[model samples]
Each structure stands twice: as structure tokens, then as C-alpha cells.
Target: MEEIKLNEVEPYVWEINKEGDMLVPGRVYGDKDIIQHLLDDVKQGKEWNALKQIKNVACLPGIQKASLAMSDVHPGYGFCIGGVGAFDVNEGVISVAGVGFDVNCGVRTMSTPFTKDEILKVQEQLADSLYNTVPAGVGSTGDIRLDKDEIDEVLLRGAKFSMERGYGTKGDLDFIEENGFISGADPEAVSDVAKRRQFKQIGTLGAGNHYLEVQYVDKVYDEAAAKAYGLSEGQVLVSIHCGSRALGHQIGTDYLKTLEAASKKYNIPIRERELVCAPFSSEEGQKYFSAVNAGINCAFANRQAIAHLARKAFTSVLGGSGDDIKTFYEIGHNNAKLEKHDVNGELKKLIVHRKGSTRAFGPGRDEVPEQYRAVGQPVLVGGTMGTHSFILHGTEKGMRDTFGSAIHGAGRAMSRKGALSCCRGNDVLRELRDKGILVRGHSIKGIAEEAPKAYKPVEEVVDVMHNTGIAKKVVSVLPLISIKG
Candidate 1:
């Protein structure tokens, strides 16, 4: 890999001038230290050298303005993780690698009236109850089995299906992106294999970096925004990190092969084979879009069911009534969406691919929930198991600058294998316990790979987002008890 010179555009922005087949400049948001660390990773060749990937992403057809990378940028399959690129709908192409296999893989946060002291008292019992109630580990399944008709409902109604089944209330939908459902999802576009896999996994939390954590608001940066989010210092909350599960993975794998073959048929030239894509108006593109929408719906439902299970654990441990806890916000990352944006001077519809990036729609955006319209959409940034998480609100500057996108999380500093080699799972659990965080998981090795040291400092990432005016910090949270898949 060649070292590209990065010019400092501002205190929080860096740019790489266009070169080779690159159609636009590459922009990254981060501090000097984070930039240097990413540069070192390129030198070591242990992970995706993100800088080159960012440049490669610029080569995609019909990309508008620039190929933007967030502070958490890391090398992914084709587009770098944390990459945000928008392309003209009429002229652009949709690539499977850009959207990722885990479509709508995201985080959801719920705040409760309980206090930190109240939670710590029953932390161990709550963790064990959650671990038992929520099916996890590789290829985990749950009690809820959906038939063909029911599967179609899940793909269309998302969290609404769970609400109708008495898992959640109507008000909960108001806080989720797209009311926890993506319209225009055609279940017929989903293959039988994908449907079969999702049949029994609706309420389960699958393995590998997915978790349900019991956290407390440690500090408030913006008091008004924190209060609007129903959070106060020492207040207990639950954060669920999950994705579309097997259904989404199957769709990506199945369609990418088709798209690759179609790319050859269409005679589209590309530097990388993983960047397989079809024109937006093509039949293949429409089919993949439908499958992607279905996957997004699956993720929304997955998080809702997991939240229901978490509520059960809370009620079992705290003896809470139905109205004691409520969902604060549910948002997704790692997906693509059709959005309207100004290109040069004309407002045009574009397909925005946010891989490992979160949509940070600014104030007045119609897509934002009415309750949060004044404050902007809430952006949940989860850290590693034993570190601080942050709540941020989208800013108008983000809309004007980066297609209304922001960093998703503290990007991985090392691969899971590398992190596990450096830290033992038992030691990590002990350390977390020492810090007053009760931890429970099915596998000890899972804990080792997700150790706090394995990821970049979330504080730094939030700082960059704040400094860059993409998102502003609302509050900071710390875990009291956590359950890992």
C-alpha cells in the first residue's frame, strides 16, 4: 500500500487529494493521535488499511462531492468501515459490499426511573436472568417461530409486530427509526433459506460483539437534551446492540454473487471484485434493494424483541410495573437509504451507503421523530465492555458537510484474534468486576476479544464528532452490569 499525504482541512478534518481512479477527495474526521494510530495500522498490515479503502471508495460511480469517512473509519470488505458516500439515484450503482451483510445492525437505548444504587443491588441476579432469558451464542434460537405468513409480517411490520404480540407498547414505535419498520419491503425478494433462518431467531441475540448492557447515566453534558432523552445522572438504562441476524447475512451473500455475475454481464469496470454493483434502475439492483429493506425490518424487530427480554429481566430483578421503564431511542447503522440532498445547487435524490456509520439527521428533517425534532435525532455511541458510552444529537453542519452521517462507535483498534491473544477473558472479567461492573457471558473467549483495550477510546471519537459539529454530546454513560452473546 502506498502512503497518501493527508492534508489537514480543519482541526477535526483531514483530506486526501484525488489520485488514480479516484473521482473525488477523501475526507476523514479525527484528531492527530487517532490519525497516527490508523497510519500505524497500515504499516503493520494487521487490519484493513483504511486510508487506501477510503480512496478506493471514491472510485465508485456517481459518488457525489466526496467520499467521507468518520473518526471510527477502518478497512471493511470494500468500503472502509465508518465510510459515508452518497450517489445520484438516476446515475448511481448500489454495491452489496457498501451496504454490508449485517444490514441495519444498530444500537437501541432505553431509560428507566430506577437509580444506579437500586440496580447495583440486584446486578448479579439481573445479569444471570438476562443471560438465561435471552438466547445467545452462535446460531442461537428462541421460542417465537414464525410461519411463512408471519415471516412476511415481520419483514413488513418490524417492531409493530412485537407490539401487537404484547411485547411493547404503541408509544415505543415513536422513538424508533422509521417507526421500527421500513416501507416497501417485499418479502418475496427474500429467499427461503433466509426466511428459514429467521423463523426462530426473532427474539434471540446472536454471538460476536452483540450484547445487552445495563448502564447508568454517569454525566450530563447538555442538560436539556439529556432531560429530553429522559436521562439523569445515576439513572439506570439498558442498551442493546444487535443486527438483522442470519436473514440479512444470507441476503447479502446470495445477492453479491448475483451482482458479481451481473457486473460482468453489464461490463462495468471496477478495481476490486468485492465492489460488485448494479445500476440503480437495473432489475438486479431493485431486487437487492428489496432484500435489503426486508433485512432492515428484521433488525428493527430483533432489537425490539431483545428489549422485551431485557424488560423482563428488569421486572424480575427490580419488581417493576409495566410503566416503570421506556425505550429512549432506537437507531440503526450499517445500512443504505434513499435520501434527498443538494448536489452543487440542485436538490436530487441519492442512495447513501453508510457502512459502520450512523445517520445523523439534523433538526427539521421530516424523518426525525416529532418528539425529537427540536433536539435532532439521538446518536448512540457504544464503547467496549468496560468503557464509557456517549449520547449525541445530530447537527445541521453534518447535513451540509457529510450527508447527515456520523461515527457509529469506537472503531476496532485490533482484530478479535489479536485482542484475545493480548488479554485473557478471565482477567478481563476480573478487571471489570473490580470496577463494579458485573459481567456474564456464555463463553469466556468472547469477553477477551471485547475487552475495553481492544477498541479506540470512545471519549476521543465523541470529541472529534463534537469538534467537527457533526454531532454534539448530550450525556455519558457507564455500565453497571452487562450480558454478552
Candidate 2:
């Protein structure tokens, strides 16, 4: 790999000016070293390299601002990981690449009143309890079984369905993004095949990068924000990271062929196969968008049910009531959401696609919960099992630039195949055990594929978020136990 050129527009910002068919310039957020690493990938002639994907996204119609990505940017199916592209509502296209196969794959963090010391005392028991309680791994099924009609209810109502089903309390909805379920989700828009896949899968944690973890706050960076968000040093937190499971994947798979034909029907240019899309107002687009909303609701319900399981695990192990644990925040990463943002001087509704990016709306936004509106929306960043995860807040600059988006995780430094060759499951398990982190998984290969060394340093990734004024750090948390799928 050799060095490639890019124009530095500002400190920590680089731009590939619009050319040929590009509708907007390509912008990236990273320091010189990080940018150089991306450039090296582009120089290597990798087909899906970050720079190429960013450029390809720029070529798409209706894109607003610039085709943007965070410092953790890396090659993805179409857009790079850490990508953000906001498009005009009327002229925009809703794409499957923008929302990965998992569909609303997200993180939900819960805070407990108990301190880390208390959790540490019962760590082993809690680990065992959660491991046995929450079903995980490939094709994992859970206690909640629903028929086809019931599956439609979950798709339509999301977390509300969970609360009504006694999976959680009603108050849990307030802390979730979009109040726990996206409205305008028509279950009819979702294919019957997709609904069938989710009958018994709701609440199960699917394999590959999905996890349920026990973590404790290790440090606080912003005292006021931390206080407002109800965090203190050594406080224990639980993070559930998964998505809509098989249903979402099937939606993406089913839509790809639908949109691929529609793209040609609509005479839309295609730079990448995963970039298949239909105009937002087109019949096909509206249906796909509605289906995506259903997928989003499925994920919300999935997390809500898992959160309930986590609360039960704590109550059973620690002799406490379920009310002791409260939801911190719940937000998705892979999504194409219709949101109003200031474009130039006027506010306009745009469909914002954040792939491997979390929405971090800054202070004063009505979308932010009233309790934390003065600070910002809570942004959950998931680190690898062996590293420290971070809690961050949205910044005004992020709203202005990256569509209120931030990195979702440390971008993969190696592929799963690459990692497996060098890291053994037992060896990785021994390493995490040495650090006093307990891990339980249904598959050893799953553990080996997600070894910490296979990912970039978490601190380095979050440093870019903090330095670029995208998402400010609130606190850092260390893992006590992780239940991996």
C-alpha cells in the first residue's frame, strides 16, 4: 500500500471533492495517522476500501452535506463503517446498505443502584445466572414464543408489546430512542417469510458480535453530564447489544432483489450492488422503508425483552427487586431515519443513514429526553469483550456536521478469518480471564472471532470521537462478565 492524496479541509478533516457523477464531496473525520491508514487501504486496491465506499456513497442521489464518516471508518458492504449520509426527504433513496442486514442493531444500557463492589462480590453467580437465563448463539430460541398474528403485534408495537407482555415495565419506553418503537411501521409491508423467522427468536441474542455484558463505570470525564445521567464512579451497568435477529436479515435479503430490479426500473445509477435503493417517495421505497421500520421495532422489542431478563438475573442473584435497575438509554446504529435537521439556514426533513454509527443528538433537541436535554442524548459505544466500553454525549458540532452521528465501536483491524488463524478461543479466554473478566459463550469459535486484538484500540477510537467534537466522553466502564453469542 502506498500513500494517496486528499485535501485537508480543516484540522482532523479531509475531503475528496466532488467529481464525475458524485453529488457531494466525500468527507472523513480522522487525524493524519488515521487518515493515512485509510489511504493505505485505498492504495492497496481493495474493492470495498473505505475511501471508495465513501466516494460511491457521494455519488448517490439526494445526499446532503457531504458523504461523511468517523475516524473508525473501514470497508463495509457499501458505505464504510462509521458512515453517515443524510438525504433530502423528497429526492432521497432509502437503501439496504445504509441499514445492514441486522437492521436496527443497537445497544441498550441499564444502570443499577448497586456499586461495582457489590456486583464484584456476586460476579460469578450473576454470570452463571445471566448465561443460563438469556438464550444466545446461532438459531437460539427463548421462552417467548409467538404465533404469526402475535409476531405482527411485536413488529407493530415494539417495546410496548414487551411491556404489555410483562417483559418489562411501561417506564422503560421513555428512555429508548423513538420512545421504544418507530411509528408508521406497517407489519403488512414486512414479508411473511421475515415474520416467520422471528416467531420464536424474539428476545434471543443471535450469534456474531452480539453480546450481553456486565460492566461497571471505571471513570467519569464530565461530572455534570455523568450526574445528570445518573452515573457515579464504580457503579455497575448492563449493556445489551444485538438487533432484529433473523427477521431483519431476511428483510434486507428480500429487499435487495426487490430494489435491484426497482433501481433499474427507476434508472438509478448503481456503483455497488449493496447500494441498491428506490426513491423515498416511490411505492417500492415507501414499502421498503415501512419494512425497515418494522425491523426497527423488532429490535426494540428484542432489547426490551433482554433488558427484562437482565433485571431478573440481577434480582435473582442480588436479592433485589426489578425496579432497582433502570434504563440509561437505547439507540440503534444501523438505520435510515427520517429526521429534521438544519440545512443551510432552514430546517428540512432528511433520511439519515447511519451504518456502524450511533445517533448522538446534542443538547436542546426535543428528541432528547427532558431529564438530560441540558447535556445531550446518551451515546453508547461498544468496545470488544476484553476492552473498556464508553458512555458519551452528543455535541452540537456533530449535529451540524455528521448528522449527529458517532462511532459505534472500534473498527475491525482484522477479519474473522484473519483473527481465527492467529487467536485460539481458549487462548483468548485465558487472556480475558487474566484480566479478571469472565466470559460465557455457546461457541468457542465465536469467542475466538471477537478477540480484542482483532479490533483497534478502543481508547484510540473514542479519542477520535472526543477530539473531533462528535461525541464527548461521559465515562468509561470495565467489563466484569460477558455473555457472548
Candidate 3:
């Protein structure tokens, strides 16, 4: 590992000046405390070497502007989690590592007409019901087992596949990012092995940081924005957080070898083999992109199925037909999308790769649903278990500064192994129960690994985004019931 140094560029902005084959500067966003933590990690010779990873991303081909890290950034495969980078579509490259193994892994919030009081009274039963209805953990299979042809349809149609099957409403599509169906998803691009791995895993919440929680809006920061998002203080909401399951992992595994070979063929210099990629216009790049896009749809459909199951669970526990649970919005944090953005005051097509980062398109953009166009895109920020999550909206400052992006979560402060060493799963469960929060999990090991102390304080991360004007906070949600895989 190489030593990386940072210089304060501005408030909440730190820069790693271009050096040693770097194509652009690397920038990270965070308050003094968070920034110091990153520096401290580097000093301690820790593996979450975010600064070095950021510098590595800056060295990639055709990278535009800079390699950007959001407030929640922590080192990941190639680009750090919360990493953001865009490149010229014709000249740039696409890496499966950039989009991450869990493609389109994201968060979706569904607000209900019920209040906190209504939910807490049955929190125990609700937790059990959710756990029973939704499949979770490693190798957990869901009720909806798709055949080969139906799986192909799911790969092509995404949430619409579930919607037509009576899983969700047609109106729910508009509230999802890319209308819950990203285009250019070709089933043929995905390998049969990847397809086989995905056959029985449609709605499962595969383990390691994936979960579904029931929460309530405990604080309203921006009244107008909260109103626009159909949120109010004391309102109950359920957040589904998972992704493409085995489908994405298999796609990444299958393409990494191809990209590594393509990198050599294209004569693209590699500072880190983890960042393997080919020119976006190259055949290898197009194939992987199409395959990854299909994986994104698979994730959308997976979440849709989970959402349907959640509705059923809520109906069984709380009374109403689940119609009262309204989709606030669904957005992916891991993805690469082709879009047109202003470059040097001129519109240019670019492929924006955001790994562990959420798209935060601002007001007036057609990408934002018409109902929310005035406020901007809703950004869902999930917190650690027993912590408070947040609802934020996009801002123009974020669009100009970070290609319309924001951090996805309170990034890991400790690895799962490290967390397990210090925390006991049974103890964590007891503590959360003491805090008036109910939790259910497949195993104690899973619970210990996701201990609340294993993450940076989410409030601090959310504050940095809010203060920096990347995303404006609307409300804070306190967990009542948590179901982890």
C-alpha cells in the first residue's frame, strides 16, 4: 500500500492533489471529525484505505472533473463505497467493480397512514410477521420460484413483471428510480450460471448489511419537503433494503475475468486490477453493461416482491389491506447510467458510475417524478440497526458539485469480524429491545456483525450532506422493528 496525503481544499472538502499517473484530483466530503477518522485510518495502516482508493479511481481512463467521495465514503473493492465518478461515454471505461457486486442494491421507503402509537403496540408481532413472510439470510429462498422463461421475463421486464403478477400497483412504478425498469437489459447478456443462481432467490434479503425495518418519523426538519414526500412526524414507514442477490454476484464474477483481459487488449494501464475495465464503446464493455443493467432490474424486481410481502405482513398484523402503505420512492445506490450532463457549459453524454452512492437529481429535472419535480429526487439514507434513518431531497449544489449524487449510509466503522469480536448478538438484541426496538434475525452471528456501534453515527453523516447542500434533510425515522438477514 502507498501512503496518501490530503490537503483541505475547502470546508467539508479535502483533496488528494494529482500525482503519479493520476488523471484528476480526488475529493472527499465530510466534516472535521469524519475527515480526521479517514486520516487516522490511513495512519494506522488500516485496510479501509479510502484516500488511496480515491487516488486509484482518479487514475482511470477518461475520468471527468474529479474522483469524488461522499460523506459516508469508506474503502470498497475498487471505487470506495460512496464513490462517484463520470467519464466521457465514447472515451471512458466501465468496470463491474465500479457498480459493485450487488448491483442496484438500494433503499425504498413506504409510508403508512398509521402513526407510531399504532405500530409500537404490536411491534413484537409485527417483527415476527415480517420475519416469517420475508425470506432472509444466506441461501434463503422465496416463495416465488421462477422458471427459466419467467426468469428471462423478469430479467427483461423488472418490477413490471411483479406488477403484472399482482405484486404491486402500476402507479408504484413512477415513484421508483428509472421507473423501476432500466432499459437496455438483455437476458442473453447474462450467463446461464448466473441465471441458475438467481432462479430461487427473487425476494430474499441476502445477508451482510441487507435488512428491512419498520420505523416512524420522529422529527420533521423541513416541513414543506416532508409534506411533499407524504411524511409527517409520528408517521410509520417500512424501509426495504436489499439487492440483486446471487444474480449480481454471479454477473460480477463472470465479467471480471473478461474485463481484466479486455484491459490488456485495449492497452489501458491498470494501477489496480480490481478496477478492471474496457472502453465504454468496446464490445466487452457493452456486454458487461447490458448484463449489469439486467442485474439492476432483477434487484428492482426483488425489492418489489419484498415490498409486496411486507404489505401482506402489515395487513396480517395491523389490519388494513396494505393499500395505506404508499411508496415514497425507491432509488439505487450502486449503478452506472448513461445520461447527458453539462460539461464545461455544454451538454455531453457521459457514463456516471456511482458505487455505494445515490443519485440526487435536483429540482426541475425531468428525471424527477412530476409530483416531486418542485422538491427534487427523494434520497433514502439507511442507518445501522437501532439508529435513526433520514429522508433527504436533492439540491442543485449537489448536481453541480457531485454529478447529482449523495452518500448512501453511515459507512462501516468496523469490519464484520472486528464487530463480532467486541459485540455479542444476544446482547445486542437485548439492548435494542431495551431501547423499545424489536429485532429478528436468522442467526446471532448476523446480529452481532451489524451491531449499531459497528457504524459511524448516521446523524453525523446525514448532517454533513445537509450542511454541504448535497441533500437537504426532510425528516428523521426511528426504528421500531428491524429484520436482518
Candidate 4:
């Protein structure tokens, strides 16, 4: 690992000074405990870690401000898991590691016009309904079967296509980020193999860290913001966490070779294989970026279809119309979006790459939905199956410092191999059941892989974000039932 020195710029903030081949400094947001963990990893001789990745990203062409990481910083493919980097459109490069293989992998939490008490009445039945209704596990296939031509439509239209196909409602668009469709997506940019992978996988919940959890608001931190989001104590909600399924992964795989070749062609020095990228204005760069947007759209469509399936399952067991469950807010953590931001005194367009980091736009941003403009965009911070999740609001400080990014979840404390080595899958299931929580997983080993002990304490993680004014807490939710893939 590279020896990186951190100088405290402020409480909960650290900076790595510009050094050899570095174009910008590296900035990390974390408290003492988090920083110590990173230091510990370095001391243990881990070659690939967040600090090193942060430094590597700073060396990339056209990187702006700083190579940033939120509180949940952890070693990832090229960028740190909670990494955020904004680049000049003309001079910047697009890295597959920044967008991640999952593409728009995110969380969509829908608030139901019901309470925990109501959910408890049919808890077991509801769990069964969800586990059976939604497809899960590796290579999970959904009921939807789209032809090649229609697959292109899903790439272009996103959730709107799902709605037109009788999944979800039109009202869902406003609550979704980018109105559920990202512009500049070219279906033709995506390969036939990627499209074929999505033929029957549109609505499936694929394995690994993806799940649908039924949660209830346990506490409210901001009354005004909670009210605006239609959340109150004991309110039941469903949060779907997944991404572009197979299509996203296929795109990432297909583009890796192209970008690697482009990296050499354009003379862009590569610090890591996953960091191979082309200048954003270059031919190969445009193709990969366009394909990535298509993957984002594919993810939006997947979540929309799954959310509607969730509605049906909820109504079947709990007795209500689909309208009873409304899309509270849908946002992705893995994305590369082109937007205008303040660069010094001038407004400049930059492509912001956020991996395992949510877009947390603060109040007064025109991009935020009108209803949430005064408060800020809702940031859904997911927790573990046995722990708590959070709904936070973007902060002005966050936008100014972090390119409007925040942690996605309690950063993983243990790898799946580590978790499986010590924990038993059935034991994990039994423990959750003993805690009065219901869990349905297609693979028991997957359950053990996500054992609660495998993650950092989410409460501790959120406190850092709130204390730093990166993102403020609005509500805390506890899971009643979870469906893991």
C-alpha cells in the first residue's frame, strides 16, 4: 500500500496533499474510529485500501475538487466504495469502477399507508407472499419476457416503460431520481448480449447484498422532513435494494476491454486495471458512458417492476389497493451523471461519479422535486437485516464538500468468505427469527454471508454523517421482515 499521510483539515475531515503525479488532493470524511480502521488496514499491509484508491483516483485526468469518500469508505474495485469524483467533461475520464458493475444499484423505499401494528397481523403471510411473488437468487428470472426490440425500449424509457407495461403507477415517476429515466441513454450503445441477459431478468432480485425488506419507522429526527416524506412513527414501508441485474454486469464486462485499449490509445496512465478509462469526450468514452446510462435505466425499470410486485404482495396479505403504497423516494448510489455545478465562481458541467454513495442534493437545488425542494432530497440509507435503516436529507455542506454524496450503508466489516467461515447460515436465520424478525432467503449461505455481525454499526455510521452536516437524519426504520437473494 502507498504510504499516505492524512492532515486534519477539520473535525471529521482529512486531506492527503497533492504529491507525485497527483492532479488534486484526496479528501476523506470520517470520524476518529473510521479513520483508525483505515489506518489499521494500512498497518496490516493491505495493498489495496481506501486511502490508496483515493490517492490513485486523484491522479486521473481532469479530476476536480478532490477524490472524495463519504463516511462508509472501504476498499473497492478502483475507487473506494463510498467514493465520489467530479470531472471536467472535456478533460475528465470515465472509469468502470466509479459506476460499478451494478450500475444504478440503489434503494427505493415506498411508504405504505399502514402501521407496524397492521403488518404484525399478517407478518408471516406477508413474508411468504413477498418471497414467493418476487424472483430471487443467482440467475433469477422474472415473469416479464421482453423481446430484443422491447429490451431496447426498457433501456431508453426506463421505469416509464415498466409503467406502460402495467407495473407501478405514473405517479411513481416524480418520486424517482431523474423522473425514472436518465437522458442521453442510447439503446444502440448497449450490446445484444447485455440485452439478451435482461430478457427474463428485468424484475428479478439477484443475489448478493440485494434484498426487499419490510421496515417500520422506529424514530424521527426531523419532524418537518418526516412529515414532508409522509413518514411517522410505526409507519410500515418496503425498501427494494437491487440494480440493473445481469444487464449492468454485462455492460461493465463488455466495456472493460474497450476502455483498457482506449486507456493505452489516449495515453491515460492507469493506476489500476479497474480504473481504465478514456477521456469523456473520446469515442470509446462516449460509448461506455452511453451504455452506463442504459444500465441505469435498466436498473430503474427493474426496481419499478419489483416495487409493483411488492405492492401486489402487500395488498394480497394486508388487504389494500396498490395505491395504498406510494413511492416515497427512489435514488441510486452507483451512477455517473452529467450536471452543472459551481466551479470556483463559474458554473461548469462535470460528470460526477458516485460509487456506493448516494446523491444527496441539498435544499434549493432545482434538480430536487418541487415538493422536497425546501427540505432537501430524501436519502435512503439502508442498514442490515437485523439492524436499522435511515431516511436522511441532503445538506448544503454535503453538496459543497462531497459533490452531494453520502454513505450508502453501514460499510461492510467482514468479507463474505470471512462471514461464512465463522457464521452458519441456518444459525443466522434462527437468530433473526428469535429476534421477532422474519427472513426469507433463497440461499441460506447467502443469509450467513450477510449476517448482522458482518457490518459496521449503522447507528454509529449515521451519527458521523449527521454530525458533519453531510446528511441529516430524518427517520430511522427497523426491519420486520426481509427477503434476501
> All candidates' TM-scores?
0.97, 0.98, 0.98, 0.98
Residues 1-485, model 1: lDDT tens digits: 56777899888899999988888999999899888876787777654577877887788788889999999887888788899988888778788887898989999899888898887788789888888888888867987888989998999888888877777855788889988999879999999999988889898888888888889999999999877767789988899999999999998889889889877777776656677888767898888888889999999998888888888877887785645678899888888899998778888899999999999988889988887888888999988789998889998999888999998999888789999899999999999999999888888998899899999888998899999899999999999888888
- The candidates, ranked best first by lDDT, are 4, 2, 3, 1
Query: Which residue pairs collide, candidate 2?
Result: none
- In candidate 3, stretches whose alpha carbon ends up further than 4 angstroms from where it belongs are 46-48
**Model 4, residue 186: C-alpha shift (Å):** 0.9
C-alpha positional error of residue 66 in candidate 2 after TM-score superposition, expressed in Å: 0.4
Among all windows of 10 consecutive residues in model 1, the one with the lowest summed lDDT is 41-50
C-alpha RMSD values across all candidates:
1.5, 1.3, 1.2, 1.0
Stretches of candidate 2 off by over 4 Å are 1-4
Leading candidate by lDDT = 4
Model 1: residues with Cα > 4 Å off, grouped in runs: 41-47
Which 10-residue window of candidate 4 scores lowest in summed lDDT?
Answer: 1-10
lDDT score of residue 128 within candidate 2 = 94
lDDT of 1: 0.87
Alpha-carbon lDDT of model 4: 0.92
Q: Compared with the true structure, what per-residue lDDT tens digits does model 2 show for residues 449-470? A: 9999999888887988898788
Score candidate 3 by TM-score against the native: 0.98
Better of 1 and 4 by TM-score: 4
